[model samples]
Target chain A: MKLLEDRIRRDGRILGTEVLKVDSFLNHQIDPELMAAIGKEFARLFADKKIDKILTVESSGIAPAVFTGLSLHVPVVFARKNKSLTLPDDVWTADVYSFTKEITNHIMIDHRFLVAGESILLIDDFLANGQAIEGLLSITQQAEAEVVGVGIVIEKTFQKGRQLLDGLGVEVESLARITSFDEGKVSFLS
Target chain B: MKLLEDRIRRDGRILGTEVLKVDSFLNHQIDPELMAAIGKEFARLFADKKIDKILTVESSGIAPAVFTGLSLHVPVVFARKNKSLTLPDDVWTADVYSFTKEITNHIMIDHRFLVAGESILLIDDFLANGQAIEGLLSITQQAEAEVVGVGIVIEKTFQKGRQLLDGLGVEVESLARITSFDEGKVSFLS
Candidate 1:
């Protein structure tokens, strides 16, 4: 977590009051070495949980989730995002509204991947509004799977996302927790 | 490569004639261990090339590209797929047509990641119609970056993808090459 926080301080770009762009290393252009270390850290954090598989959304989440899956020795399933409201058959689906993009996407996972009673650990790049994680949790519930915990790469603590997850009583762990963006700079939650 | 071939032989599902669904390991439901092995294989295959970065499309390509980036000690940049034709500023973009999905996607890479004269290794999950790689190549060209080689997880030799890459004079290495899907069974190009 220190490494991640340090990297965020060094490379993260602050946009307006609440936006943090880590495209240089975390999301768009990825640092695989850092991802491997993050994977190890997540593995250590969730060492006690019985995780059958790791679940995440497509694109950004796949990198961290796969590395964590390697460290945890589990399979990873990424929920695909479909912009249309018309849901596909034979898949566990949930609608996620992204405040940044200002659009609602129907995220889905093929029913063949997740099974009943399977233990899943959700992973994502950033926990802003928690809409993405909420969608994953919805699909997990639909499949009758158990969520052991949620692992986030970067979390905005000032946002409503953390509070929402806390209300659900889900154990959430983020490598870097941002308290605020003061004077166009990142302020980590100590 | 043998490990991957064996995995496909055992787990890959054959649809009708030409389609091979490898959702269990390669794409949707990913096995990180296998992906690690794949990363190592790609590293070995491209060991001679002076690769400054690894490039691939988002979602499915991130897993293998990150693993390969870890092994190669380089950064991985995934091109984002934008459905809308409206191009964003300050990014290198290319249009790709997916034969399977029958849709055209404009893939974009941030200009900050790729630099002129930088050597890049293009990585992807599958090589069917080569449109994805073609798009990446186009973007690389736009950035004036040199593509050293291409690493593909699975290649359908019968498809036009292989021939297209061959025509472009790009060095391509596929871990598992499928000659045909005869009688709903996979046949390796060995």
Candidate 2:
């Protein structure tokens, strides 16, 4: 977590007050070494929960999900942003609003992947509005699966995401939690 | 490569001549151990080539790309499927037609991540019509970057993806090359 926070300070760009652009190393362009370390840290944090699967949304979440899955020796199921033809007829879906794109898209997971009674850990790159994680949670709930915990690489504490998850009574862990971005400088919630 | 071929034979479901769904381990629900093995295989196959970075598309490609990047000890830059607010103004974009979605989507890469004269190894989950790689090639070409080679997890040999890459004079190594999948029985090219 220290390493991740340090990396965020060094490379993360504060886009106004709401967004932290980690495109240099986190999401758009990935640092696999750092990612593996993050994964290890997540695994270390959630090692007690006994996770059967790591669930995430597509695109950005795949990197850390893969890494965490590697460390935990579990399978990672990423919910698709679009309903591709390859996806089977039976799927667990939830509507997720994209604040960036200013649209709502249905995130889906094949029903075969998320079976009943499986324990799932949700992972993602950034948790700001918490819509993405909420969507993932919807799918997990629909599958009649158990929600172990939520693992996040970077979290915006100023936003309602953590509060929202707290209301759901879900255990949440974020490697880097950003408290504020005042004057384009990132401040963390120590 | 042999291991991957064997995995496809064992777990892969043939939907038709074109679609081989390995979502159980490859794409949707990822087996990190198997993916790490794949990453090792790709590293072994492209050991001779000096690759500075591994480039891939988001969603499915991120898992193997991250694994491959870890094994190779390099950065993995994935092209964004949608234009996100986090990405900067300057970007290299390309239009790619998805046979599954039956629509064309623009994939973009942050210009800063890719520099001129950097040798990149393109990695992907599947090589079907080769449009994804072609779109990546366009981005690489625009950046003035040199593509060392292409590493594909599964290549549909019946399709023109390999031939297209061959025509481009690019070295391509497919872990599993499917010659035919007629009647749902996969036949691989030796």
Candidate 3:
């Protein structure tokens, strides 16, 4: 976790006061070694829980989720944003609104992949307003799977995402939590 | 490679004559163990090459790319389908046409991640018509990166993908190569 925080501070760019661009290492251009470390950290954090599978949204979350799945020795299932021709018809889906994209999209998972009673750990790259996490939680609930915990690479604590997950009584683990961004200077939640 | 062929035969579904869905283990619901096997296989195939980084497109390719990066002890860089707020302006991009989606979308990678003369291995889930591979090749050319080879989980040999790559003199290693899919039967090139 300290490594991730340090990396974020060194490589992360603050866009104005709200957006944090970690494309240099986290999202677009991934640091696989760092991802492996974060994955180990998540595994350590959720060591008590029996995680049967790891679930995440497509595009950004796949790398860390795959790494986490590797550390946990579990399969990683990514929810697809678009309904592709290859996707199965029988799916568990949820409508998620992307604040950045400003559009609502359906994230779906094949019903066969998520079995009932399986313990799942949801992983994501960023947690801003919690819409993506909510969507993943909805899919997990629909599958009757138990969510052991949610692992996040970076979280904006000033946002309502943490409170929303807390309201749902979900155990959320974040490697880096941003407390505030003032005049382009970022502060972390101690 | 045999492991991958076995997986495809067991879990892969042949939809009509055009689509084969392996969402059970490859793309949608990923098997990390199997992915590790595939990654090891890729590493073995490209072991002689000096791979600086693993390059892939977003969504499906991320899983194997991550595993491959882990096996090779290198970073993985994925080209995003759409430009997001987090994406930097200094990027190498290309437009790709998805025959499945019947739409043309732009894929971009930050210039910071891909440097000139770096050896990159392009990883993808499927190699069908080679349009995606061509786009990636174009992006690599733009960045002046040397594409060591292309690694594909499955290749539809009946399609023009292989021929296109051959025309470009790019070496392609496909774990499972499908010769044809006709009359609900899938044939592999042995």
Candidate 4:
């Protein structure tokens, strides 16, 4: 976790006192070694739970989810943003509103992928308003599956995404929790 | 490669002659163990090339790219479909036509990630008409980066995607080459 926090401080770009761009090493341009370490830490934190599948949204979440899948030795099911020609007709769907993009999109997972009674671990790159995680949780609940926990690469604690998810009684393990942002300076909860 | 061909035969769904759906394992629902093996195989195939970074598109390619990056000990950079608020204004962009989706979208990579003269290895989940690869190649060229080679999980030889890329003088290494798909049966060129 120290590695991630240090890297964020050194390489992260703060824009408009709200957005922290760690694209150089975390999302857009990824350091697989560092990504793998974060995944291993997630596996370690959730060592007590039995995870059958790792669920995530498309795009950004795929890397961390894939790495977590690698360490956990479980399959990863990424919920697609749109209905693709390849995806099946029978699917579990949830509507999520992205405050950043100022748009609402449907995220779906094929019914066959999320089997009933399966233990799911949700993973993503960042948590802002918790819309993405809520959408994923909705899909998991529809399948009658149990959510083991969540593993986030970064968290904006000031956004209170933690409280939003915690209210649902979902356990979250974020590698780096951003406590505040003042005058372009970022602070960590850890 | 045998492992990949075997997986295709077992789990890959053939939709008509144009699409081979491996969503259950390769894309939508990912098998990390199998994904890891594919990455290792890609690293083996491109071992001769000196790759400084692994470049791929977002979503599907992230899993294998992550694995390939792990094996090659290089950073992974995924080109995003749309520009978000977080991405910097300075980026290299390309327009791609998705025959499957019947839509044209732009894929872009940060100018800082793909440096000039850096050797890059392009990785992806599937190659049909080589549109995605071509888009990536265009971005790489804009960055003045050298493309070492391309690592494809599956290539539909019948569609002649390989020929398209090969015509451009780009080296392509596909784990499982599909020769034909007739009567709902898939044939591999392994």
Candidate 5:
């Protein structure tokens, strides 16, 4: 976690007040070494949990999810952003509103992949408004699967995402939590 | 390569005459152990090339790209399907037509991540009509980066993807090459 926080502090860019761009090593461009370390941390945190599968959304979440899946020695199921022709007939879907894109899109996972009573861990790159996490949780519920926990690489703590998840009583672990970004200077929480 | 070919023969699904779905292990749900093996295989194939980065499209390609990047100890840069606020101002973009989706969409990569003259290895989950690979190649060319080679997990030999790449003189290595899939029986070309 210290390594992730340090990397964020060094490479993360503060765009205005509400946005943090980590394209250099987190999202768009991935540092596989750092990602492996982060994956190890998540695996260490949830080592005791019975995680049958790792779930995440498309694009950004795929990197960390793959690493976490590797560490946990489980299969990673990524929800596709759009319904492709190749998708199976039976699927569990939820509408997620993207604050960054300002559009509502459906994320889906084939029902055949997630079984009933399976334990799943959700992973993602960023948690801002918690909409994406909420959608993933909805899909898990639909499948009758148990969400063991949520692992996030970077979290915007100043936002209500953590509060929302806390209200739901879900255990959330974040590598780096942003406390504030005032005048382009970033601060960490705790 | 035998391991991958066996996986495709065992788990891959043939949908009509056009689509071959490997959702069980390749795309929607990923087997990390198999992916690690694939990463090792890719490393073996491209051992001679000095690859500075691994480039691929988002979603499915991220998993294998992550593993490949881990083996090579390099960064993995994934081109995002949609333009988000987090994306940098300057970008190298390309239009990719999805054979399955029946629509053309643009993929973008941040200009800062790809440096000119850097050797990159393009990796993907599938190579159908070669449109996605062509799009990735276009983005790399726009950034003035040298594409050392292209690696695909599964290649449909019946399609024109390989021919297109062969025309370009790009060294392509597919773990499993599909010769045909008729009456639910899949045949491998290599």
Candidate 6:
């Protein structure tokens, strides 16, 4: 966790008073070694939970979720943002509203992949408004799967996402928690 | 390679005579243990190439590329399919036509991640028509980067992609090479 927090401090860029651009290392351009470490840390944190599978959204969440799947020896399922020709008809889906893109993406997972009564661990890159996580949770609930926990790479505590998850009573673990941004500097929650 | 081939044979679904659905392991729902092996295999294949970075497109490509980056100890940069508010205006952009989706996506790579004269190894989930690879190649060329080789998870020899890459005189290594699909059965190229 300290490793991630330190790297974030050194490489992370602040956009205005809200966005923390980690495309340099976390999302767009990835450092696999760092991702591997982050994966191991997530594995350590959720070692006690009964995680049958790990779920995440496509594009950004696949890297961290897959590495965590590697360490945990579980399968990682990424909810697709779009309905592709290859995708089948039977699927569990939910709509996610992205505040940044200002678009509502219909995210779905194949029903064959997620079974009822399976223990799911939701992993993601950032937890800001919590729309993505909420969508995944909705799908899991529809599938009758139990969401055991959530592992976030970076979380903005100032946002409403943290409170939303807290109200749901799910155990959320974020590697780096940002409390506020002061003068283009990140302030982590102590 | 045997492991991956075996996985495809076991879990891969043949849709009609052209499509091979590998969402069970390769793309949608990922098996990290297999992915780790895949990473090691790609590293072994490109060990001789001086790869300064691993480049691929976002979503599906991130999994294999990140794992490959881990094995090679290099940075992995995935071209974003869409431009977000966080992305800077300065970027190398290309238009990729997805035959499956019937859409032209404007993929971009931040100019800061890729450097001139750096050797890059292009990684992707599938090489059907080689449109994604060609797009990445164009971006790399625009950035003045050298593409040393390409690592593909699956290659359809029946498609024109192989011939295109061959004509370009670029070294390509595909983990599973499919010669044809006979009556819903996959035939691998030996």
Interface RMSD of each: 0.5, 0.7, 1.2, 0.8, 0.8, 0.6
| Candidate 1, superposed: residue stretches over 4 Å from native | none
- For model 1, which pairs clash? none
User: What DockQ do you compute for every candidate structure?
Assistant: 0.94, 0.88, 0.77, 0.87, 0.85, 0.91
Winning candidate number (TM-score): 1
**Model 5 vs. true fold: TM:** 0.95
**lDDT (Cα, tens digit) per residue for candidate 2, span B1-190:** 7788888889999874578889999888999998899899999999999999999998789999999999999999999886443544698888889997687778998889999999999999999999999999999999999999999999998787788899877678888888998877888888
Q: State, as a TM-score between 0 and 1, how close model 2 is to the true structure.
A: 0.95
Candidates 1 and 5 compared: the better one by DockQ is 1
lDDT of 1 by residue, A1-190 (tens): 8999899889989889988999999889999999999999999999999999999998899989999999999999999999875777999999999998888899999999999999999999999989999999999999999999999999999888898889877678999999999898788888
Q: Which stretches of candidate 2 lie over 4 Å from their true place?
A: A83-89, B83-89
Candidate 5 residue B105 Cα shift, in angstroms, is 0.7
Q: What is the DockQ of candidate 5?
A: 0.85
What's the residue-level lDDT of A18 in candidate 5?
A: 95
Clashing pairs in 5: none
Over the stretch B1-190, how does candidate 3's per-residue lDDT look in tens digits?
8888888888889987879999888888888788888988999999998999999998899888888888899889998896343555788888888998788778888888899999999999999998888999999999999998999999999888889888877678999999877877768888
Best by DockQ: 1
lDDT top scorer:
1
Clashing pairs in 6: none
Task: After the best TM-score superposition of candidate 4, give how far the Cα of residue A61 lies from its true spot, in angstroms.
Answer: 0.9
Q: What is the C-alpha lDDT profile of model 4 across A63-167, one tens digit per residue?
A: 888888888999999999963435446989888888877888889999889989999999988999999998999999999999989989999998867888788
- Model 4 lDDT per residue over B1-190, tens place: 8998999999988887788889999889999899889889999898888899999998889999999999999999998886343445698988777898788768999898998999999999889988889999999999999998999999898775788887877678999988888888888874
Question: Which lDDT values do the candidates have, in the order given?
Answer: 0.93, 0.89, 0.88, 0.88, 0.89, 0.92
Error of 3 at B53 (Å): 2.1
Instruction: Name the lDDT of candidate 1.
Output: 0.93
Alpha-carbon lDDT of model 4:
0.88
User: For every model shown, what is its TM-score relative to the native structure?
Assistant: 0.99, 0.95, 0.93, 0.95, 0.95, 0.96
Worst 10 residues of 4 chain A by lDDT: A80-89
